[model samples]
Target: MAAVLSVYLDLALGLVVTFLLLSLLVSGINEAVVRLLSIRSKFLWAYLRDTMDGAGPHGSWLPTRVVDVFRTMPFLRDPRPAHEARPAPASAGEVPETGTGASMINLLYERVREIDHGKQGRTSIAEIPPARFAVAVMELAAANGDVEGLLARLKQMGSPLYGHLKGVWESAQGDLDRFRKGVESWFDGEMERLSMLYKRYAKWVLAVLGVAVTLLFSMDGLEYAKTLLRDDAFRASVTAVAGSGQGAYDELKARCTGAGDPVTCVTETLSEPALVKLMGQALVSVSLPADGEPEVRWNGGAWWDRVSTPSHWPGFVLTSVALLFGAPFWWDVLRRIAGLRSRR
Candidate 1:
C-alpha cells in the first residue's frame, strides 16, 4: 500500500507540474492579447455610452450631448498641451456651441470621430475610480451644481437613469455630497457586473489560445503522462522539480503581485533572459522533448497529418482542457501533492 501510494503521488505531481508550466505559457500569451486589444477600455466606453443614452422620448440629440462628455473626463484627457496634439479630422467639422439640439448632435458626432482617430494611449483608459465617474456624470447632468436643474433635466429626459438618481437624491435628503456618494456606490455595483462579463469573455479567449498553443507545441498530455509513468528517471526528475518548494509559478506570482500592473509585470517577468534560460536548462535537465519528439515529430510525413493523426487527438484534447483550469489551480495541486509526499 505504501509503495502504491508513492507511485500515485509521483504521477499526480508530474502531471500537475506539466499542466502548470503549459498554463503559465498560455496565460502570458493571453495577457498579451488582452492588453494589446484593450478590451477593458472598449467595454468601459460602451457602458458609458449606453448608460448616458437614456433611451428617453427625447431625440438622439440629448443622449449625444451627454455621451460627448465622456471624452472630456479628466482621466481620458492628456494634460500636456505641447505634445503635438493632432487636430480633429477636417471631415468632423467644427461644432458650434449653439445650445440647440442640432448643434449638440453634431458635437456628439465630432467627439466620436475624434475618439475613433485618437492616439492609442490617450483614448484608452481601462480604469476610472467610482467617485470620479459619479462626479463627472453629476457635473454633466447638473449645470453649476444645481440639484433642481439636474433633477428637472433628468426627469425631462424620461430615462430610467432619472429614477435611479432620484432615489439616490431622496436618500441623501438633497445633500450634494451624499448624493455623489450614492452615485459612486451605484457605479461600483455596475463595475462588479462588468467584471463578471469580462471574465466570461476571457474564458473564451483562453479556450482558443489553449488550442493554438497545444497545436503549436504539439503537446500530447496523455502521451507525456504515459511516458512519465513508465520512465522512472524522467518521472523522478519531474517530481523532484515539483517538490523543490520554489517554483516558476510561485516566483512569477510574487513578482506580479508586487508590480503596479499584474499583466505588465507578467509580460516583463516572463521575458527576462535569465528566467527563460533557467527554465530551458531545467527542461533540458529532465530530457523533456523540446519540439514534441517520441510522440509527435516535425519531420514525420506531412506536417499537418503528423499532428492530426487520430492517435494524437486524445492527447491534444486532454492538454488543451487541462490548460483551461489555469496555472494557479495546477500550482496549488502541485504544492499539495508535494506536501503529502514530504510527510511520508
Candidate 2:
C-alpha cells in the first residue's frame, strides 16, 4: 500500500516540478522582455496622459509656448525684464492669480493651480494636502463654474478621465469634505487597478511558458498516471526512489531555485530535456523499455502520428493544468508523503 501510494505521489511530484520549472522560465523571460521593451515607461506615459496632464503637448496646447499669463516657465524665462515684472501669472477666473490651467506641466500642476488660495504658488499636488484639492474645486464652483457644468465641459474637452469621477462629485452634493475623501478613494482604486494589471501580465507569461515546457518534455500527466497504475515493477521501482528521496530531485531543486536568471536554468538544466532523457540518466531502476526492447531516440514517433493519437491529447492537457498548481504545491505534497513514509 505504501509503495502504491508512493507511485502516485512520485508522478504527481514530477509533473509539478515540470510546471514549476516552466513557470520560472516564463518569469525570467518576462523580466527580460520588460527590461528590453521598457514597457513600463509606455504604461507610465499612458497613465500620465489618461489621468494626469491632459492639456500638455498632445493635450490642448501645442509644443511651442503659450504667451498668455499661463505660459509655462521654460527653465530660463527672461528675468521679468526687471523693468516689467508683472503679476506672476493668473488663470482666467476670480480664483487666485498665481498660475492657470493653460500651459501646465501635468495633471498635478493643473490640480494645484485650481486649489491655490494665497496666490503664493507654494501649494502643489506633491505636498499640498488633499483638502486643498477640494478647496480648489469649490473655488472653481463658486467663481468660474458650477461643479456639474465644469465636469460636463471637461468631458466635452476630452478630459474623459475626470468623467469617471462624476459620481463621486454628485454624491458629495457640494460637500467639500466628502468630495475630498471620494477623490482619495478614486486615486487608491486606480493604483489597485495598476497592481492587478501587473499580476495579470505575470500569469500570462507563466501560462505561455507552461505550454512550451510541457511540449518540450513530452510529459503527459494522464499517461504517466496510467503507466504507474498498470506496470507493477516500474511503479514499485519509482515508489522506492521517491520515498527514499532521489539525489536528482535535490539537484533540480537547487538548480532551479539557485539560478538567479532563468535563462541560465534553460541552458544548464533543461538543455538536456527532462522526462525523455533525465529519466534514464537519473534513475537506474526506472527504465520504461524492457532490457531487450530497442531504445528509440528523440520522442520516437513522427509528428502527426503522435499528435493525432487520441490517447496523447488528454494527458498533455492534464500535465498543463497540473503545472498551474505551481512548484510550491507539489513540493509540499511530496514532503508530506515522504514524512509519512519515514514514520511508517
Candidate 3:
C-alpha cells in the first residue's frame, strides 16, 4: 500500500508542475495582450459614449435636453445645448470636433439637438426621419449636400464608428436603398472583424508567453517523460500507488481539478525546492554525466551544454510543442491517466 501511494504521489507532483506552468502561461498572455492593446480601456470608452448619446425612448440620461426652462415653458425647452446660442464659427461649415476626445459628449449633445429639432435646420431636413447616431452625420450629410462629401468627412473625423459608416456608404454605390442595406451588412461584418482581431492577437500573445514561461521554469515535457520512463526506481514507485484501483485514481483526479483552484491546490501541497528539482532534472537530463549531480542551476552554461548534447534537441522540441497544446489538453490527459488505475 505504501509503495502504491508513493507511486501516485510522484504522478501527483508531476501534475502539479504542469498545472502551474499552464496557469502561468495563460495569465501572462492575458496580461501582455491587455497591456499591449489597452482592450479594457477602449471597451469602457465605447460603452460610455453609447450610453451618454442614447436616443431611444428608454435611454438619454441627461435632464431636459438643453434645459429650455421658462416660468411657464420648462417642458417646452429646446433640445439644443446652452452652448447652442453661440455654437461655433460659420456654424454652417462647423461640425463638432467630437473624435477621440471629451468632444464625444459634446458630439452626442449636438446629435440629440438635431434629432429633436430637424436634420436640415429647417422644415426640409427636419422632415427626414431621425437617423440613429450620436454624431450629426446626417446633418453633416445634409450640410455637405452630397453623400460623397459626408463620407469623406466621416473618414477625416478619426472615429472608428464613423469610419465604419463611411465604408457602409461607399459600398452602397449611391443607391439610397442599397445604402440602407449596406449599413446593416457592414455592421455585421465589423462585429465579426472585432472577434477575429482578438483571436489573432491572442494567439500571438500566447506564443510569446509560452516561450517565456518555458524558459523561466526550465520545463521540457518530452525530456521529463523520457527520464521518468527510463528511471525504473521512479516508475516502480508510482505504479504501486496507481495499483490501488479506481478510488485512488478518482481522488487524484479530484485533486487535479481541486475545489478552489486546481493549480493553486496542487502548488500549496508541493514545495518550491521540490518543483525546482523536477524542472532542473527535465532541463538537463540528457547531458547530465553519470558522475555529475542533477542539481544544476538554470544558466547560459547549462542551456549551451544541454543543446550541444547529441540527443537533447528532439526532447526540447517535443516539450515546446506539448506546451503549445495548452493547459486544458494536459488537464484532460492527467485525468484520463489517473482513471487508468481502475481499468488495470
The models' CA-based lDDT, in order, is 0.58, 0.49, 0.47
Writing each residue's lDDT as its tens digit, candidate 2 over 252-309 gives 4444686788556635443343354433322121334435766544533543354556
- Looking at model 3, the pairs that clash are 4-240, 4-241, 5-241, 7-237, 7-238
Write candidate 1's Cα lDDT for 1-344 as tens digits.
88667767766777788789889999999888666655566556555544543322332221123233233322343221111235434333332222234222222333333233334533555556787667555554444246666556545544345577788889989788898999999889988987776676668778888988777666777766665554443334334546874443454454456688866655554444332322232212222333664332233344356376799899889989999999989987887877744333
Local lDDT at 311 for model 1? 94
Once model 1 is optimally superposed onto the true structure by TM-score, how far is the C-alpha of residue 313 displaced, in angstroms? Answer: 1.7
Q: Evaluate model 2: give its lDDT.
A: 0.49
| Candidate 3 weakest ten by summed lDDT | 65-74
Give Cα distance to truth, residue 197, candidate 2, Å: 5.9
Q: lDDT per residue, candidate 3, 1-344, as tens digits?
A: 89667655665557445654665566666777564443433332233234333332343322222221111112222232233433333233433444443234354344444424322231111111223441244444566666676555545654345555666677776776666666546544544554564455455556656665555545555566544443434334334446865433443444356356755544543323344444554343323433666444446577556656657657555555556666756766666655633333
TM-score of 1: 0.61
Every model's TM-score: 0.61, 0.46, 0.42
Global local distance difference test of model 3: 0.47
Per-residue lDDT value at 132 in model 1? 65
